[model samples]
Target: MTIVDTALHDSLRVLKLSGMLHTLDARLVQAQAGELGHLEFLQVLCHDEITRRETMSMQRRLRRARFEQTTTLEEFDFHASPKLPAAQIR
Candidate 1:
């Protein structure tokens, strides 16, 4: 990374913009390749940060819920419990 890039990254880190920091390099590459305008580049960075934060929030919530395993109704073995009404589950 260049000196300017390093300085910018440090500033972002100090400001606690970790999501942006993580995606900065990739976004820069995309901007260069696509010739994105300044506003468009900023938009991409902000969008990535928002998405990263939302995904992190969901993972944290899931961890707090302490699920033994993830499963869907389709994966359930209805044959094992024929007496149970499968239609009600839907």
Candidate 2:
């Protein structure tokens, strides 16, 4: 992998580890803005290893939440309900 790709891969790993992408638009990004945009986004983030890890950790936390992945209304309701036990949020 190029530096960009390597950094992006690492950042992505960290994001997954930290569970940040759960909040974004959910799942895959827009179909039209695939590969090329992905590469650009990675490049934009790959400036330095320290910056990359720091950003990955920060954005990963803020970018997405795991609850967004639910499609079922019942599951969504339960996840959204603050009264529900934390364990059941999945």
Candidate 3:
């Protein structure tokens, strides 16, 4: 495994690369073992960052909406509302 210097670690944090930082050690190990190609390692890091941002964005939007409760169509009890158009909603 490669050792990440304090300077580089701080740089990554300053640059807001939390997702990549989180998995850097494991990825480094894979790279050292020749399990991951250079491009693939970068791709994985980018994917992690993208997924993290998307999830955070969604949560922020939901909090801003101030909904009393969040529920999906699948969570709705069809049996509780037999008169409602559950099939059509689905």
Query: How many pairs collide in each candidate, listed in order?
Result: 0, 4, 0
Query: Predicted candidate 3: what Cα RMSD to the true structure?
Result: 3.4
Q: Which residue segments of model 1 deviate by more than 4 Å?
A: 72-90
Clashing pairs in 3: none
- The ten-residue window of minimal lDDT in model 1 covers 29-38
Top candidate by TM-score: 3
Scored by lDDT, model 2 comes in at 0.50
In terms of TM-score, which candidate is stronger, 1 or 3? 3
lDDT at 78 for candidate 1?
89
TM-score of 1: 0.72
Instruction: Write one digit per residue (lDDT tens) for candidate 2, span 4-89.
Output: 74675577667653332232222235423574367654443343344546878776875576555545544455645678775655
Candidate 2 ranges beyond 4 A from true positions: 17-90
For each candidate, what is the lDDT?
0.90, 0.50, 0.85
Q: How far off is residue 42 in model 1, in Å?
A: 0.3
* Native RMSD of candidate 1 (Å): 4.2
Clashing residue pairs, candidate 2?
20-60, 22-65, 23-64, 23-65
Task: Give lDDT: candidate 3, residue 51.
Answer: 85
- Give each model a TM-score: 0.72, 0.21, 0.73
Give the per-residue lDDT of model 3 (tens digit) for 2-86.
Answer: 2555666687799998987888778878987998899998898888888888999999999999999998899989899899999
